[model samples]
Target: MKRKIFAGLAIRELREARGLTQLDLARRIGVSPSYMSQIEANQRSLSGTVIIELARVLRVDVSAFSSDDGVRLAATLREVLGDPTFGGLDMTQQELKNAALHAPKMARALVDLHRIYRRVEERYRSLDDALRASDGTVGSHQSAFEEVRDYFHFIGNYVDPLDRAAESLADRIGARSEDSLSRLSHHLETIHGISVSRHSTADGGGFVSTLDRARRTLLLNDSLPQATLAFAVARHLATLTLSDEIDAVVQAASFRGSDASAVCAATLANYFAGSLLMPYQQFAEEARRMQHDIERLATQFGVSIEQVCHRLSTLQRPGNEGIPIYFLRVDRAGNITKRHSATRLQFARYGGACPIWNIHEAFETPDRFLVQVAEMPDGDQYLSVAHAITKGGGRFDAARLRYAIGFGCELAYANEFVYSDVIDTRKSSAAVKIGVSCRLCDRSDCRQRATPPFDRRVTVDPDQRNIVPYQLG
Candidate 1:
């Protein structure tokens, strides 16, 4: 099925930004002014050819008109509305989707207000605990983190200026060469007059890397893997070399506080470091040749498997875009530590993931990749791959961190993935039914549901019971 593009607001904003009138854009894209007006008014859907031409004329990626934001927003709205407080409203899916598409700002404002309400409610409930612990107040760190996360999420997770700058720097520093690590160290020492040194675990104070600006020295943990060492160096270099680009992004974001701004800056710097290490064009081409085999990409780029998966999610480079993959990292407790999706498979923002998803199962088997074909309640199928990664704990006294890294694309593009060959994509029966989370899920017969659907009434029978204790009505 083809997706209908109703990107009138986005197109109008871009045209105005570029100082182009409707008639001017119409003439440029070989369409009549009246037709362009309809497109802007969202009275007509944009065809594939027209979308491409509009992208070319507007100097934006074709994905600018994608329905991803609308879909993600609608899903979030659905989850928000699933709360029992809104049960009396009885909103429909189409109405929520229209709100997402046509009144996005208002929809976002509602989501934000709901988030604030949730936070306040949580804090209120925990006030007694906080008083007993003498903590005084709940911190705003999570709020700042979410603000930064959503900034990247809404922008499609691609920072073009920083990415290009990193790519250029990579070429200059010979990022693809075997001696890249040495080259990076040399570049920092020579160009920035900063000396790099490795320290034992005890001397490094449990930190992976630390910069002493006054002494012009960088201290790296000796226990870290070579890949991590290189990444640390590259990240520092990005902060030094791409400060202007990073600042521009931070300034444009208008984050709520200095904390969010600082977090966004660090994240953008890390993004630049990843781009510097992988070099977008070269990495994308090699990824295609290797069938996106995470192990091979990790080996080729001298990076960790987790890094490879994360980088794969950021390959949304306009006309040269790679497969739209969703990547996430989960700890042993099933809390998602990292997440990004260029696909329609958005993860739950407020709770744990579906228990039936293979990512949670990845913890059972170490040092191996697990693949699954999953069908969401929305009927979208995906080919997912998950692998567990253990980091740190090189010494007996040090603690080890275990996380499962998962990444996948839709089944339509499953053939492009190496893991897809082992699964029968054609068999609908093979696809395990899953949902984002139990609270917002509408699946009535799932025995593995940890919680009842929020929007549904539960029926308890004294006569009999099924695998699940209560039936959803």
Candidate 2:
């Protein structure tokens, strides 16, 4: 309320940041330095002649300092009505601002409802995560896509025994992630005779989707270069090496839904393939030998960039763990296709990611590498590097541009990766502190903001001019 300007201190901070020393400011405002200090120190009061002087000096409107919002809410109405963006709409700005102030609770609820309408899956995932960490049991999902992402989150993106087996293969054959993928494919073919094949999307969408209930044929697509190779490899391993164990894990899970079963099955195969490529002993040996250079590992194994990225996502296998990695794949438009985590990243399951996030920036640079150190709202620092790789045919006749893979992990283990060699470690991880979207991110000082979270207050009145839109107490 203007009658009770909640942020006289905020005004002082603005003055200081503008490089005006208290004495200099007092001289310009024709006030004693002692009086200015008293205002800042909260010893003297702020009203009337002082408020007018402040409005004049600070270049703010006199009404902002003189009247409470309840009184000036009518005046704030003018600024909103005059806004050209609302010119075409039937509602006036004052009506909008008054609705926003007098009943901000309703305004926030309306905003939230609109956001959910645009992206329900993300909200559902948030709810699911809240329920997961709170209770031991799982909650029902309102969005199928969210359900899918939530299901994957629960597994920590690691497949147990198969991953171990893959690690063993890594020791015997090699620890190259690509090599592991190739060998896993070979192992699956040799052991199960369940060959990989491609299918039309019209017939049945993907490898993991189509299961032969009649024939024990585990139909899979090899067209998907990285995950697919490892996938079929893991599939063979599951049906062959860890058949009983997988059956046990699946049975014990008591999970329902065909899609959920398919996802779990894919996860199991990937775990095995990861193990074969990095076999615990061989991987640990090569990881040390290569010093965890991800590019070098991909080169050594003759695999696509994403394969190596996906393999990095599986470094967590309990007793013989590797550096934990979090991998996210987003299209040029920043739609996340896949997310694998061995770290504490509560990524949004649906909707566009924050524009400030490095993943989106990586798209513009295309083939070039981007590395950034980011801190979350909760104060956890993470090291992230991203680059794009071709996904479709390379023929000028039919080739499609590749999607970028944004993969990185917490800084605590950054020393183990190839990316550790160059990035300046001195700068505060300031630019990296990004929130999801406003619906989820709760940062108090963002100016490129679209809307505040449902809980944040509009720190300043529209009638009251502040450089940045809001002031937080």
Model 1 TM-score on a 0 to 1 scale: 0.94
Superposed on all Cα atoms, model 1 deviates from the true structure by an RMSD in Å of: 2.2
Cα lDDT tens digits for candidate 2, 1-473: 22243234545766777788888778877889998887765456576677777767777655343222222333223322322333323454346644644454455445334434534444356775655655633333333344345445555556566665655555655535545555554554565565544443333233342445345355544344554445455545555667677666666655545545555555566556555554556555666578667677666665556766777666655446677778888887777788866665556544566667778877678767788887767566778888877754422343355587888777777777767667754567433777655544568876655655544445667687655677654
What lDDT, from 0 to 1, does candidate 1 have?
0.88
Worst 10 residues of 2 by lDDT: 66-75
Q: lDDT at 103 for candidate 1?
A: 91
Candidate number achieving the greatest lDDT relative to the actual structure: 1
Worst 10 residues of 1 by lDDT: 128-137
In order, what lDDT does every prediction score?
Answer: 0.88, 0.58
CA lDDT of 291 in candidate 1?
97
Q: Kindly report which residue stretches of model 2 are placed more than 4 angstroms away from their true locations once superposed.
A: 1-145, 168-244, 394-401, 429-431, 463-473
Candidate 1 per-residue lDDT, tens place, 272-318, comes to 88898899999999999999999999899988898889899999887
Q: Clash totals for all models, in order?
A: 0, 13
As a whole number from 0 to 100, the lDDT of residue 333 in candidate 2 is: 76
